[model samples]
Target: MSSYYEDSVTLVAAKEILASLVESWALFRLLCLSQNLWAQEGCFPIPIISATPGSVIPWNESVKILCWGTPESYLYQLEILRNSTFEVVEKKLGFQEKAEFLISHMNTNTAGRYQCQYRKEYKLSEHSKTLELVVTDIMNQDYTMENLIRMGMAGLVLVVLLAIVIGNWHSHKVPNKEDWPDFPELSRSKHKCQTGPLDKALRDTRALCGKAYCKPGNKKTLPS
Candidate 1:
């Protein structure tokens, strides 16, 4: 009786050990499957990123960056790196499947490559393809053109004003009559207060007339 009882107890203990081993193996398999599923979900798809108004943007213009990912992803991270300096310029976090980042005014400093990644629970997805951003000097270009136009207009105005002034000055000048050449007919009437043939003839004629006209009663001789 005692031997039979001991064998029964031993058999019961063996069965319990087998059951525990089976349970442990099943749990291990379940844990592995869970981990594998999580990893597969994390790596299935990558995020997609794009820039609004194209990659090349004008200076001082607003720019919008969009990041898209699977709906399962509850969080996203956006990053920007400047190619010239090889430095990270921005990092942003978003809680939605789609994220948007806005740069109010794009500049040289804000121009570079961009990327994004998604996270679900503790797993992170691969970063999206690189998107390049280029900021152009549109403002400077316009300003230079405007300056040239203004300069040209100013120069033309100055030329016109100078021409008008020259014309007015020429028109206001008065002619000097003394600078004119003398006429032959007017030379005889002109007197220089010097004794000449004309003057002597006139004096003799005046004396003869006085002598002929004088009467004896006057007796006064005409002075020569």
Candidate 2:
């Protein structure tokens, strides 16, 4: 009967009983009190840990992690897998002291995921939930003005070639109508600016006298 009572009073078993209840500040304080009260009641300290996964770290930069736990024995480490299958693994130690790691460059690959591993002096602690980071080519311009210009010129050439193939020709016409002559209107305007050499040849001789066309020695009229 004593053995059954001892097993029932253990701190591990006590915490297990507390786990079923919703966690809150009051509940946590009660469980802690129970653990302290049961120290003479012969039980190991229940392990507590805090870590963040599902976070993102950009490529080509340092990855930083933070982890804290009770009893001061919980040591944290961060690691990454190079390949998709995790066939290659990279690990580090002492994240509680220094939580930063640098990403190594690869020839082809761009993105990867990181995870935190915590241990109390074991080779592998339960790995954290995975966090993913994205990598991109800083060199490539996605949409450039030069590329758009080239595409537009190519499309214009293609359209012109198709029009030629479809038997279309454009008739040429000048815009300013005054630049082209109107012969009848110019001849009949009866202005000083309208006199021309070809028109002078067709006029009757009985018109009003002009000194410009008069013979030099025959200017005087004979009783007209």
Candidate 3:
């Protein structure tokens, strides 16, 4: 009777051990399956990114950077390249697999290469393609060389105008009598002015009388 009882106890113990081993194997298989599923879910596709109002923005203006990812994504991150390394600048919760980051009062500090990423649970998706942001304020800034050139041109124009005005003034001025060229009629008038009254009367009588009347050997009537 003792021997039969010992056999029964030993067989019962053996069955219990086999049951425990089967349960452990089943649990290990289930754990492996769950890990595979988690890994598959974590492997997400790369996200897409774009900027609104164009990637080129004016200083003090605003821009909207949009990122899109898989529907399962719950969080989105925006990163910028600074000093050759990427740093997260903003984050947003995903909605419909999309996220928007509004950057206001944009300046030189805000302009650079940017990227976006999305996270689903504990795994993050691959980063999106780089987008370049450009900020311009050329109209407002003063360039030394450009300003100097403009000033030099303006001064040159003023000098030219002054020279023209002076030339016109000099041209319009009345010339002195001494500056005028001498003519036969002017010389004769000057000679007349220098002559005496008796010479002037003799010249008038010769002018009124004919040359034949004035001749020593001829006689003719002179006009009254």
TM-score of each: 0.47, 0.30, 0.46
lDDT by residue (1-224, candidate 1, tens digit) is 99999999999999999999999999999999999998787564888999997898988898888888876677777777744443434455645668777888988778788888778767878888999898889645658778899999999999999999999998888757995678665454364554699888988877776674565577666665
**lDDT by residue for model 3 (68-131), tens:** 9978788999999999999999988745588999999888999999999998867788899999
Q: Best TM-score goes to which candidate?
A: 1
lDDT of each: 0.80, 0.52, 0.90
Candidate 1 segments exceeding 4 Å error:
1-44, 57-61, 82-95, 105-109, 136-144, 166-224
What's the lDDT of the predicted structure labeled candidate 1? 0.80
lDDT of 2 by residue, 1-224 (tens): 99888887896778876775546667899989998756632332322222233133233434334433223333555555664544324344543432434444422352455566545544334455665665444455366888899999999999999888665434354537876787565444467657688668656443534544465677566345
C-alpha RMSD values across all candidates = 9.7, 17.9, 10.9
Give the 10-residue window scoring lowest on summed lDDT in candidate 3.
215-224
How far in Å is the alpha carbon of 137 misplaced in model 3?
A: 1.3
Error of 3 at 47 (Å): 0.4
Error of 2 at 115 (Å): 1.5
